[model samples]
Target: MKAPDFDYLRPETLAEAMDMLSRHGEDGAIIAGGQSLLPLLNFRLAGPERLIDIGRLAALKQIVDGDGFVEIGALVRHCDLASSEAVARAFPLLRQAVGHIAHPAVRHRGTIGGSLAMADPAAELGACCLALEAEMSLQSVRGQRWVRAVDFFAGIYETALAPDEILTAVRLPRRGPDSVQIFSEVARRRGDFAIAGLALVADNHMANPRLALLGVADRPILAEKTMALLANNMAAADQAIELIGNEIDPAEDPAYPPAYRRQLVRTLLRRTLMELLP
Candidate 1:
């Protein structure tokens, strides 16, 4: 199906884009990489009155490694993040997870900001952000504010972003010298969206582990019960594995039932723990 008729506005600067957004309010949809938005439009899932193109906003295309953190601009492509030396050194979990996103052609055009803003329950980047405790920068005519990854996602295809705000960048802490990262997912095929996935980061000896799971709920979620159990005592792996079923509320899908997803989550947790703790 073709997209409905819409007014297209291309903004030359970030400020201009924000102004346009402020004026259009809920009637406008911002398109940066267009990898996600185009599909929604093509399927007639979204029909904004005005399509605000901010793809050429150069200010949101940088990868800045700063003191104790690395800030990735919204327009940074998935493929670029996968191949970045700074990302590899600081956030290996993200670099590894990007490989599971989709085919190369999609990755070449998909932006991290677009993925986060879309708030897909099964997107790898959103889960990685949660594991890393990344913060998103949201800007609008009203002002700018930072939101933690855990609070940014509202639900399936929804976010905390106000209608007039744009997610400008994401700030992620640099991995400590002794940090260890792990990423794994279960999918019907390579490059397919995972039925369930895990992104974990921890200090050496698996202390202070942060485990974030995707495709197990309405949005990517931190396994707080599991993390707390492991944090309190690494020996409680068996109990922590059991806690996941209680923590996650996965909806039944036609292809994958809720029981299957819960089991997959358990298996992922078990495998990850064995690799990290054994």
Candidate 2:
């Protein structure tokens, strides 16, 4: 089905986009790469009265290295992240996650901000951001604010973003020494939405690890309990699987049953931990 009729505005600057979003309120939606939103529009799942396209807003398209973090413009595409040497060095998990997003063509057109804003529970980007403990930069006519990844995702296809707020950037902490990262997922086919996924990051010296699970919950979720288990026995693979299956709530869908998903999560979590351990 074709999308419903709607007015379109391509803003050249952040100020212009915010102004348009403020005026339109919930009737408007921002379009970055249009990879996700366009499909929703075409299916009539989303029929915003106005589309404020910020794909050309240069201010929201930059990737800057900071003292302790990297600020990535929301409009940066998956392909950009995959090939960026800076991103690769600072956050290899992000690079790995983006490469698994969909396909080369989709990665070329799908923006990091778009994927996060879409908030698909099965998307690798969402899981990676949570695993990295990234922060989201949100803007509105009133002002700007930052929301941590743990707080950004509310539920399935839901986010903490206000109707008038546009996600402007993602801030990721710089990698520390002895940091090991792993990302793995099980999809029915290459580039398909994952049936189960896991992203893990550990700093052996710090003795802290972040475990994030996807495609098994209402939203991408950080497995704090699993992480706690890792602190005790970084080599206890079975413990990691048990914690993930017992603590995390797996979603049941036509694609997979809850029991099956739990088992897949166990398998993926084991795989992720093995890759992250020495």
Candidate 3:
């Protein structure tokens, strides 16, 4: 189905985009790469009076390397991240995960910020950002604020992004000297949504372990208990798996039920520990 009648706009600057969004308020919807929003619009799931396009804003397209993090612009595409030397150096696991998001065509058109803002449960970037403890920059006409990845995601298809706010950039932590990262998923097809996915980032000695689990809940969830177990003692892998199996609250689907997904999660967790732990 075609999208309903709506006003289309392309703002030249971030300020202009903010002004348009503020003016339209609830009637406006932000569009960057249009990878996520266009499908929603086509399905009639989202109908807005104004479409604020910020794809032309050059400032939002920049990638800056900071002392401890890479300041990745919100408008950066998935394919761009996959090929970016900066991204590879800072977050190689993220670069690998980006390659698994949908297909090459989708990656070419999908913006990193758009995927994060959409907060899809099975999205690889959000889980990777969480595992990497990335920071998101939220801007508005009022002011700007930074939100941690752990707090930015609210629920499935939801985030801390306000009606008048825009996600400007993401601050991804640079890989440390002893950093070890891994991403794995069980998808029916090579480019399909993951049935169960996980992203893990930690040091060689299991210090500061960060594990993010996806496709088993309403949001991409940080496995705090499991991470704690890994941090305290990697030998408690079985116990941690049991804890996650009990904690999982996946939506009931006839084909892939909660039990199956939880089992997948357990398997993935075990495999991750086995491969990474010395």
Candidate 4:
């Protein structure tokens, strides 16, 4: 099936994109990478009246490093992030995580903004962002504001971004010298969406650890209880692993049952924690 009839608008500037979105409102859909949206359009699952192409907007493609954090433009594709030396130096976990996101061809076209905005809980980036406490930059014709990763995702295929708001950038704090970031997942096949995944950011197991799990619920979940356990007693990693079953509510997919997915989470979590060892 071909995409339904829609007016294609290519906006050259961020301001121009904002105005286009404001005019189209709910009827318009933003297409950055088109990795996710094009398939939906081809399947006839989504039929928007307008396609606002912001792919070429310079503001959304710029990656800037600040004193305390690194800001990635929303339009930055997976391949861009995976190949970024800056991203590797500052946040190696992200570079490692992006590798698990489909194949190279798909990565070349999939945008970080598209993935986060789509809010697929199974995707690696969302969990990584949650572990890093990345702040989402959103803008609209009215104004702009930052949303915490935890708050940005509301549910499956849903986000806090209003109809008029476009995700402009994602801000990730610099990894501390003592921090260790771990990312791993279990999937049926390589590059396929993981059945379960884990992203862990720990600073000597004393500071508050950031733990996020993917494909476990409606959205990426921060494992506060497990993190607390590890923080209080680093040796309690074993116990924290066991508590994941009780802590998260993973859905029952037809391919991977709920019990198996939870088990996969446990396996991935254990594997991730082992990385903390010398």
Q: Which tens-of-lDDT digit does each residue in 95-152 have in candidate 2?
A: 8887678999998889999999999989998999998989999999999999999999
Worst 10 residues of 4 by lDDT: 201-210
Off by over 4 Å in 2: 276-278
Highest lDDT: which candidate? 1
Q: For candidate 1, lDDT tens digit of each residue in 149-172?
A: 999999999999999999999999
TM-score of each: 0.96, 0.96, 0.96, 0.97
> Roughly what TM-score does model 1 have, to 2 decimal places?
0.96
What are the Cα lDDT values of the candidates?
0.91, 0.87, 0.88, 0.89
- Candidate 3 local lDDT, 25-73, one digit each (tens): 6889999999889989999999999899988888988889889889999
Please report, as a residue range, the 10-residue window in candidate 3 with the lowest summed lDDT: 229-238
For 110-220, candidate 4 gives per-residue lDDT tens digits of 999999999988999999999999999999999999999999999999999999999999999887887788899888899988878999887765477888999889999
Compute the lDDT of residue 201 as modeled in candidate 3.
96
| Candidate 2 backbone overlaps, count | 0
Displacement of the residue 48 alpha carbon in candidate 4, Å:
0.3
- Rank all candidate structures by their lDDT, best first, as comma-separated numbers: 1, 4, 3, 2
Model 3 residue runs over 4 Å out of place are none
Alpha-carbon shift of residue 198 in model 4 (angstroms): 0.4
